[model samples]
Target: MDGNKALIAYETKGGATEEAAQKIAEILRSKYQLEVDLVDLKEQKMPDLSQYRNLVIGGGVRAGRVYDKVLKFLENDLSGKRVAFFVSSAQAGTPGSYEKAKIKFVENTLAKYPKINPVATEAFGGRIKILGKTVTDNRDMVKVEAWAEELGKKFTQ
Candidate 1:
């Protein structure tokens, strides 16, 4: 509650965003020994930011749109906090589309919240669904772990 604690708040469409949040929490807890909380944007309200030392916020993208709740959270006062933002989308994991996805996410989300300067930001590949059928999953654990690890290091520094 006081030190080495982080909150990972996220919104999901088909659970990809939630999965990414959980993976980040797991990596932080296991590798960095940090206490991480995974919050579902739809099910729970935002906790007091003053309680945590760091924050990680993410959302899933659908049809080039991000969840409104994720954007709202970014509107908060995040100065003097270590923060990171990420997005999960089908295009994010594609070979040539990842850069575009990152640009789109930053332009749409991060650009709107210029006050919230994240130490690290990324766009991860998410699962694709067609008519409720799983088409593709591009979530990479290696990437997730590395990002999470870097987040921990930022806090320690």
Candidate 2:
């Protein structure tokens, strides 16, 4: 268990975060031929950080913060690691109230892990709308998958 592997974990409330995680995993796999593992915060217990060399985390932005599980998981043992984080927010391009909230979420999360050398950390745009048995305005997982592939390029440099 050397610290050279890549791990991607996520907590998605309405499946958006999971979609982003899958995209990131595919990107790393297809571009760099890297073996990335996806850990669902809800389904699995937290894994030891020392077991991997690289780590990526993503979760849903709810109310004004990352999902509770993601917050708790990354709070511990994030020092001296190559890490990246992302949140799936309902707000994509507009710097509105939700956007600021997302930024705060990132800020607070990063505050806990000051030593993380993240090459990239940003919120994936769009959201999951659930209202009375209807849905609208979901971000495309395909794009995230492609972006994840592109983001992997960061590791090469």
Q: How does candidate 2 score on lDDT?
A: 0.72
The backbone clash count of each candidate, in order, is: 0, 4
Model 1, range 1-157, lDDT digits (tens) per residue?
3568889999998888888788888888887888888889889977888888789999998878888889888888888888899999889899999888999975567887878778899898999888999989988978887888888788667
RMSD of each: 1.5, 2.8
TM-score of 1: 0.93
Least lDDT summed over 10 consecutive residues: which range in candidate 1?
105-114
Per-residue lDDT tens digits for candidate 2, residues 69-142, read 88887776766566788888776434565567556767667777666667677766655566634354546666
Candidate 2 lDDT for residue 100 = 74
Identify the runs in model 2 with alpha carbons over 4 angstroms from their true place.
1-4, 93-102, 131-134, 138-147
Residue 103, candidate 1: Cα error in Å is 0.6
